[model samples]
Target: MSKRVARIGIFIALAMIFSYIEVLIPFSFGIPGVKLGVANIVVVTGLYMLKPQEVFFISILRILLIGLLFGNVMTLSYSLAGGILSFVVMYIFKKLGSFSIIGVSAAGGVFHNLGQIIVAAFILKNEKILYYFPVLIIAGVVTGILIGFVSDKVIKTLKIQDFSENLK
Candidate 1:
């Protein structure tokens, strides 16, 4: 139990670090809600190594922590919506057992953007925000593929199967 807790702690820290790193990077597509989402590398890896519930917990915790430290209410709300939606999409894809990490992550990224756009439209009471959906979806797929590749490498390097076995 302690070991699982410790691992979850590590994952949260790693996710936070990735989020911070993303903030440092100036890469942007001039589209709001479009991002490399490097932090999702941690989420993708966790999905493969940890239980779904544990990964969800870590993801939500990371979002809350990052929000408290560097964001306001709006940011937190957008993040919560996107994170929850993306996690659900990714988990479903993973459970289907037909998609690779890249596919699952790509779906997650698209849905993440969708989630944010939905929130934006709702909050601003303007349907114009939906116009950004297509661009964001493209960005999501590209970034999701990249994130998935990195996650695959990380999983292979860490021998996550072995770690999961040890935990079991």
Candidate 2:
């Protein structure tokens, strides 16, 4: 395989490992389901370094890997909705705006939760699910911003621009 493809694989594997780690660090905010999204570091790094299409591929692959390992087949719908929405939001920001890495990452976090809420609404077939929208959106906004800030710090401290440039 090409060096570039190998790099992609390595990052994907790293993403999976990070994701599993997130799963284990359970401090659920007592909200049934919420997280700090540390695993998003990989996604943010990939987006900053790779093209839009490549980022999309990484997002889907990571989601699939996580779902298959710990999630049921029925959960694919949630992953699909969340992953696609998150990618679209981040890609739009990166392509059309002047937001830094953290900004895009934050937006992706919000978008991911929005997507999952949507999936939940559809799956449960209940309009009451709309009630959770506000809470989840709040969670998304806060978590997104936090992770974005963290990613920003990581990028600056780690000199990620060099790697990003090479990957591109």
Winner by TM-score: 1
TM-score of 1: 0.94
lDDT of 1 by residue, 95-127 (tens): 999999999999999988888889988999999
TM-score of each: 0.94, 0.90
> RMSD to the native, candidate 1?
1.6
Candidate of highest lDDT: 1
lDDT of 2 at 81: 90
Q: Write the per-residue lDDT of candidate 2 for residues 1-168, one digit (tens) a residue.
A: 386788778778988888898778864677876877677777786776666787788888988999999888767778779889988999899887798776787789888999988888888999898788888888888888887777777666656457655554
Error of 2 at 168 (Å): 4.5
| TM-score for candidate 2, residues paired by index | 0.90
Give all candidates' CA lDDT scores.
0.90, 0.80
